[model samples]
Target: MPRIGVYNGFDPVDVCSYCIEVLKVTAMGRASLRAMPLTHLKAYLSAYGLRGPSHAVEKEDYVRAVLDARQSNGCLPRVNEDYYRRHSIPQPTGERPKGFLARMAESFSDFVDSLPQPDLSSHAPPPPPLPPRQTAPRPPPRTTANRPPPSMPPRPQATPGPSNSRPAPQPTQSNPPRQSNPPPPPPSTQRPTPQPLPIDNLLTMKPEELSALSIGVLKAILQHHHVRIPQDALEKRDLVDRVATLVEAARAEKEREARARAAEEEAELEAQRQALEEIERKKKAAAQKDDTGASEGQASQEEIPVAVPKAAAHAAAKLERDGLCVICQDEDANIAIVDCGHLCLCLGCSELVMQSSKECPLCRTRIVTSQRLLRIFKT
Candidate 1:
């Protein structure tokens, strides 16, 4: 069996030398190897007998391993060209038969080349010269013969001197006798006034009659009666109803407010009168007490010293001590529960309360967090 090369130019030496040169150029920064895709780089590494991590090998590390392998081995490992040719079919060795048309064409070309010998030295003649072309003469330009010259302007005539023959018409009666202002221009023809539409007539008027009236005139009438019409009330009947309802409601509200203000004023006056009467009654009681004191002057002086009770002082002291935390009853209540702002617990108890219930103990308001009081003495 005859052997055939599967790859025609399978030069292992040239391939290894080219890969070595590429790696050297890449390492010198003359070319970039990092830009190559991962799959291509892995294939390149495997072909060169350089092993890399199976998974999660970084691009830079894989490229470095390839360079290192090239340095140690001096070149990329060669692939077996003979192994590639093992499965290739053998090429045929016998000569190919020529077609009939091809053989005929070859024979005709050979015969033509042998017979071609034309003698043009005695038979050839020089070419004749061409005749010169003729052209027509151009026509002459037109002339303007009879155009007239521009005419000169006429000179001004001298004004005629006022002749003494006429007497100047006697000054026209000296300013035409003043004319008496032309009798006041005959008084303009007056426009007849439009009659005002009464409210009662408006209520009974038909829609067609209302539509005939101008919108401006209707608006003016409504304004005179202190009525407010809605801007969107464009139709004639809508305008009438809107104005009437607004005016009636306004009048009723005004009356109601006036009555309420009057009642309030009356009540205030009555309270003031009662207060004055009470003041008079207190004055009368003090006068009676003074008369009794005059009858017992010595006992009245002694009673004045004992009027303030001792229990009131004890109650005020107890209230002052309540500012301490109710839970510990030792530290001053300084932490305020959030959302509720209750300062009934100290900082320590507030944390415990947040962990346990996350709510204000007094108001049961959900406690999102708490804040410390800078001034615990403040109410």
Candidate 2:
């Protein structure tokens, strides 16, 4: 069957087919394996009872896996010379074969072989044999006659002094034992100096932490941060206290600044709110004023009293005339004597009339008591 993964339009299939057809196998016989599509290689692997190339990312990996399986298990089918001969079909020789260069090479070789050959035995004589190598005679052994004299003369030994005259042997002196410089003052019990703390950390250090530092370290820190150190701060505790006080003051100042900023922001917000309220109140008042002005204009236009007809005017006049006291018309006749029921006296006139005489004007009856009139009107 045609290669299983062949697809006419797909780029991967096209590429794989191109590789397999155009590329020659490498010396290691892995070019075909590497060129084959991943799917085709994976399919071949299944027949050999090997795992697919699912784990193999690169072409080399696939090639390696295939090579390992093929060599080790010999599971993949192979075609030998006999297999090819058995399967090969003979084609009819209609015209001459296509290999013109092979035909030409064969003809040239036959022509060369058919030509006369040169005989070297009769043409040239053999070269003369080389003479036997002569060995040189040996030289005589080195003797005293051949030896040369020394370059310098040897010196003579000094004569020994008389045995009694020899100087007495000097006494052998013994060296006194060395005093090994007292064991280096027992390495004074000094601890390693600590590295200086960072300025930021020093600024934030607590009282206890400050107390742990040496007075010199504390002073150095204060100098680095440009803090004014008190002259009396000689002791370690005093330095620690000074540092602590500075830290607290800095923290408090920071907090105060933050609070002040927050208060300023709040004040700004409150002012904005009040301004908005004032704007709204002004809008409402202006609206109400507009409404009031409209109402006043309408009132000015419509509030004129309608002229009364003569009859209504006469009736109103008669009513008013009747309401006044007959004695003195200055005040309204709001009081009436009870027994007589005469409505003629004003409140002031009623008192005077009661004091003068307990009598009604029209009936002339004695007035037992008086009551004020309250008029009622229904629209």
Candidate 3:
């Protein structure tokens, strides 16, 4: 008989369906909805035949509702490239609502749109078309021969004789001309101010990205980086080139300084190592010297210096052969008495002996100067 297997709630088909739904909502639908402005989001819902959120509803709620609708509809009527192009959603100039003020403005705009608008065409009728302007018929031009002579009234000859005596000169009043104010100066043309770019990641921006900015903005960037713009660099391309050159130079300089600092640190470490080695060598030499002094004292105590006139020559020869200084007997005789020409003092004892006696220890002759000597021995 076959063994019965226990049933678990894991189903591949159900998991696959859940994954597809998640992809549709999150990867495709929800992201686009969240990025859209309130107007565009409503337009998107209307385009897909889904109920758009009310003016009072929050933006997140609207986004979630849209996502749910898309999921329930099995991803049909999707917010894909075709839908964007058809409905003109996410217009190039449109930006998503940013801060509190922007969100409030978006909410207010949605509320205004929700209100019923009066039909302007029916309420305010268009003015009737103005009747065609009536123009009088033009009369025909008259020739000199057909033209009528001017009519003249008969002049009163009797009244002309008494005109000066009868008519008193009326008082003539002259009026001053009115002064007019001068016209205002024409409006001056303003240079366009640079606007900050949406992308603030200037450090990692490429040359092409910088080139896309306007000349004013490029200058602003150069100013921000404290890079000097050359007097002759007027064009946008020239500014971009200048910026690239300066940035590269700065980077190179920084790297060079870093390398110099590292080299200095390494030199300091090397000097410290040499100093440590020198100290260790001195310590070892001192330790050996102490041991030798102890052994020499022990030997001196064991042996007694008798009056040995017969073996004096043999003892001097033995001291020379052993390369021991006569005064110290611990170090090598590496210094020579100048006048007497005897190597009997070690470098350490030579200074002390000369200061005390000012004469050679072996010959007892007046010493002029002491000189350090090097000895070579044949194997």
Candidate 4:
């Protein structure tokens, strides 16, 4: 077949590398198991299959989760053979592995053992105690004391010593400022008002969930919180629709920002890609560039000599000799290179890879997202 030359914007494989780098796995969290090589992860998965080694997988995931968090920024390294060898630990096979691979596995295991485990504290609340039995009220105490009685006076003949001076000026108390004895409210001063807690509104919340939601989230929650509304309550429908629309728009905006961030990181990492070195190797490419073109009275804009196809091929062969993939292998099965040549599988494997790693799988060259994905086959 004739050698097909494609000059496009970016390579898919390189893009994938960007993605991988952004998605760093090392920081993904080391299992509490310790600094285990990443290889044992495969073994762990293999051993458990369906019902998992909860502890092991959890440990791995914990670390991977951390890495995943950073992947969005393309700051993570690619998961390649080296990565697997460097990070993975082998599980204990009943009969130990023999030879170099076996020894390597053992070493990896040591690394895992070196990882720290999360402390599993028993902080869960104890079960509720049985209700106390009702008790009868106690009677007042009867004190025993000898007492003297009777000093009786003769009954006073009706009414004299009358209204002695207006009943001794009716005794009065300067009532201390009427004590404001209001009941103390519950501990949390931030309890939602009962008005906002209509049966309908409360229902939408998670069962017994006190969502500390923002105003926008709150409005969205309201739409679904209430149970049933009357047919004629068009206002409810309108409000719900409005809130839903607003929420969707906000979520979309957030996602766009996240992707943009990832893209930026991918670009930075790509700028450091090694593939550009091919440009330095080619004399023809160098000759194509007119260093004095600027002073030569620029006819139209002068174009610089980019790396040539032959040089790129030689770079690829060299990288292969060093055991590197021709293109940056993003996590995806496929990869892509742009303009200078090639594409991975049909899907935008390059883009996906870019999201994960910074290095190309094939040439192990550093790459950027600005490189175009020219649809051409890799030799």
Candidate 5:
């Protein structure tokens, strides 16, 4: 029996059937056979029972066999070239199809045609028939059957002579006694007077004493006296100083108006004092700057000397505490060799050195015995 190869889990027969039915590949065409790899060519030929004399088949033989098989099967469907050329029309390039728009327009027209139309005839009732024309009734004929007589003229009466007769006087009644009105109340004896508030000595008052007063009272006093305090001066000391200065200035101006020569002398002295104070303040500020620069330089120089030994000692102690074994230098030293008394090897390095040689790595002294040191826990 010939060895049959399977393609895509389907036996040779199924693969060929699927390719012909689904892929529409003719058995005679080498195009479909060439679609797969060359290794699958033998399988393709075996699928259609197109085996050669030998078990092994060449690609050309397999292709020829496929072609012969397709030809023996039947004729292929004919291509209608003239029919396509006559009926088929090519759409303009880049233009969208008008079929969808035409369909939508048709549907919209159908919907409009299906809508209910209003009945104009039945919308309004016909106007009522005009009422028959009628003429007004003629008035009755006039007659003078009940005519009233004309009114008679009034009769005249003769005038009577005047008589000398007077009416008698009515008896007079006595009048009631009249009461007098009471006298008006006497005028108020005394007028109430407003007492003046006591003024405190602002110049002598301390900041603590000024702060004890309510802010509203202090503001009222300042406003009443017409003393201008700085809007930003919300602190008690600032308000007290401003009030005192205003009062003193007002008093001084009054005195100055009274004594002009004395006022000039005082003004000159005040100006000189202010000038001296400004000069002293500048001098003190310069001295403070120089002192601060000198102190900063001295501190920096002093810190350097004190810091050097502390850093050096700290580094040395750290090295002694956790330094690696001198032998291997890869691990901490936990073993001290006897006779040499040098703790220079880790547990691993000590074991290795002991087995290889009995000599200390640091001193080169003969190591008769090795001692493994227990790790000491420091409090």
Candidate 6:
């Protein structure tokens, strides 16, 4: 008889189905009821409250599996790309809500209020104000010659001081009556002088973002306050900061790129050095071959004392033998720079080689004609 076996391959851990059902119900808290399938809709019913614990776990696991499969299959919907950004979901870790619904409602209200109101595209413009009417000028009142002068009250007299032992006497004074016509208001002292804005200072402001403000409002506000920045200044300030930051970032990035390029050049130089070493190794190998292959008649145990570096040996010999510029071999030497040798064909080579390149092909010394080079041999 064949042995009985449980389900095979990708066997999920056994979980109570009843427990899963309850979990599925909770996890589906925000799922749209209208779009949910009939079978899922039936399972979500509150009638399942009386179900057993094992059944709930199993249902949750099943729902979890379904969601997992969908996600793995690359079909999961993106509900909130911007929802969880740098500052989104600012809740602290290791926290649990006392009540979920209340929190949700409050968060939702705050988020909704944060959005700007829609423009009223249908509103009509207000009519322009009416013009003022013209009025006739009134004539000044005529003065009467027979009019009696008004009586005037006497100014208050100072109270007399009493003797040291005598009691002080008290006197009563009535309060002044209020007048209907008040004294003419003090003359206006304000000067209507128009001041020119310092174009140099205002030019420092980010003009790109200034288009939002009216010229009148900008000029008025810029006046009377030089340091206290307005809230709208943030809009302009952000652009300035952005440009500055971009420039800084660009500089940093350029420096980084330059460093990378320099590192690459250094690596390339090292490779070239290795290649030259290899070439020298090959040359030494060839020289050894030539020495070994020499016939007995031509070969001598006492080798000729030739300079190891053939090129430098030639220059040393030429300077010693000729006592002149090896190039022109001119006995008459003149026109020299300090430290550098005065060996050249003529004044033409002196100008061309000295001024044009200034580098000696032999030692690679940079020669400055004005600085002058020493004549090791006067010739």
Stretches > 4 Å off in candidate 3: 1-203, 224-232, 294-379
lDDT tens digits by residue: candidate 1, 1-379: 1123664332333333324433443344213667665555564454344577666457887667666654332444334223222322123347453332333345557878999699885755544444444444568986688767857976644754465232333322222233465555677898664454665566555656666676666766554343445678868777656445534444454465466556556656655666776678667757876777664654464355333234444433443455567778755565665465677776567667767987777788876543322213232
Misplaced by over 4 Å in model 4 are 1-234, 274-379
Residue 178 of candidate 5: its Cα lDDT?
52
Q: Candidate 2: deviation at residue 104, Å? A: 99
Estimate TM-scores for all models: 0.22, 0.24, 0.24, 0.18, 0.15, 0.18
Better of 2 and 5 by TM-score: 2
Residues 165-204 of candidate 5 have per-residue lDDT tens digits of 3234454444444557788899988854333122436545
Query: By summed lDDT, which 10 consecutive residues of candidate 4 come out lowest?
Result: 15-24
Sequence-dependent TM-score of model 3: 0.24
Name the top lDDT candidate.
3
Candidate 6 per-residue lDDT over residues 1-379, each given as its tens digit: 1122764334334544433443344445324433444345333331222222344443454444334432332332233213222222335557553232334446557879999988775554444455455454578898877877777976645764553233434443444455589889999998655453443344445545444544444534333222123356545554344333433433454465466556556656655666786678657656776887755523442253322355434433433433234456533333344444434433334545665777664566776543344322121
Which runs in model 2 stand beyond 4 Å of their true positions? 1-204, 214-217, 224-226, 294-379
- In model 5, pairs of residues that clash are none
lDDT of 2: 0.54
Clash number for each model: 0, 0, 0, 75, 0, 28
* lDDT of prediction 4: 0.43
> Ranking by lDDT, best first?
3, 2, 1, 5, 6, 4
lDDT of 3 by residue, 1-379 (tens): 1122675332334333312422333345566767767665564455445666566468887787667664343453445535534653333435542433234456678999999988797755455454445455678986678656777977767657653344444544444445688999999999877754432365467878777877788777555433456688757789878666645544554465466556556656655666776678657756776878676754554364433343443434433446577977765564665466786776457668757877778888876543322221212
What TM-score, to 2 decimals, does candidate 5 have?
0.15
Off by over 4 Å in 6: 1-234, 293-379
Pairs that collide in candidate 1 are none
